[model samples]
Target: MKTFPTIETERLILRQLRPEDSVDLYNYFSKDEVTEFYDLDSFTELQQAESLIRIFNDRFITQQGIRWGITLKTEDKVIGTCGFHNWSKKHFKAEIGYELSPEYWGIGVMTEVLREVINFGYKELELNRIEAFTYPDNIKSRKLLEKSGLSEEGYLKKYYYVKQRFVDAVIFSIIKEEVTNDERSKN
Candidate 1:
């Protein structure tokens, strides 16, 4: 996609991250609770947020991946983000990542966002598979992925080195045929 795609749901908008969103991004990222399961440490500076926005945009520009800033339809400030990273067009697959403010947790926001984003992955990105990896202890994330129609694949022992230590990851994935069958069943 040449121009950034903007998606809207009943209460939220998934749009490209802008420089002005630095403050909102920093607000949640600076909180330890928000970054607890993430690979990176809690953001300590506003510049870190700014740099992250730049990297997200750069990923889209280079066709590496696309990350959308999540904001409420009633507000312009970003409250979270969800998108695909580690995209591989050749293999027709990508890894999904997301984070939301603690204040917005358990409100069905990420669930709605994932539904739309995953649809885009299959329809627009032509991806056959969408995968997510989370810390084994992140029950919330694992449950959310299951609710979103992804199935647990298995554990990857010491899959990632984060915070100066090796951490294990639980993999979840869904394929195009599964999504298609799901939609067909709903109809």
Candidate 2:
């Protein structure tokens, strides 16, 4: 199994999910506004979040992909989760996905954490490519990807079935490059 050493950003800690963080995650996910653009169903109850966290813990040992809990250093709260998944083994490619609480939106937290995780995927995990898909309506995430130096590739109409409706997904990505290496070198 592959282990992720703890990763730190200026105001946050990117670490493996824990059972105790279920409530914080639930608090974030339970909001209609937060989950409105995200793919997951809204967390109705706190216990469901705990159950999901337990499953996330098991997933770490399995090591097929990684889902990290984004925790704030200031408040000791889990603000969101992001991960690599939907892999193509032969191609050495995988899609990255992320969601954050409404409270943390527009603060640049996800941008910092994503740059760290993407570099980890390249340098430590030996991936050649990492990409992300977002609904066309998700301008916030698209901006984050752009700020991290990814470019829009194309649009896939009805690219995903989310929230019981067909939605357009805009694909954005970064190839291994000097720019990507530049992001990797930052502490």
- Candidate 1's error at 13, in angstroms? 0.8
Per-prediction TM-score: 0.99, 0.88
TM-score of 1: 0.99
Mark the regions of model 1 whose C-alpha exceeds 4 Å error after superposition.
Answer: none
Candidate 2 per-residue lDDT, tens place, 43-95, comes to 88899899877766665666666788998887777899887876565777778
Model 2's alpha-carbon lDDT is 0.81
> Candidate 1: deviation at residue 68, Å?
0.4
Cα lDDT tens digits for candidate 1, 129-158: 999999999999999999999999999999
Worst 10 residues of 2 by lDDT: 55-64
The global C-alpha lDDT for each of the candidates, from Candidate 1 onward, is 0.96, 0.81
Cα deviation in Å at residue 176, candidate 2? 1.3
Number of the predicted model whose lDDT against the real structure is largest: 1
Evaluated at residue 84, the lDDT of candidate 1 is: 95
**Clash pairs of candidate 1?**
none
State the weakest 10-residue window (summed lDDT) of model 1. Answer: 33-42
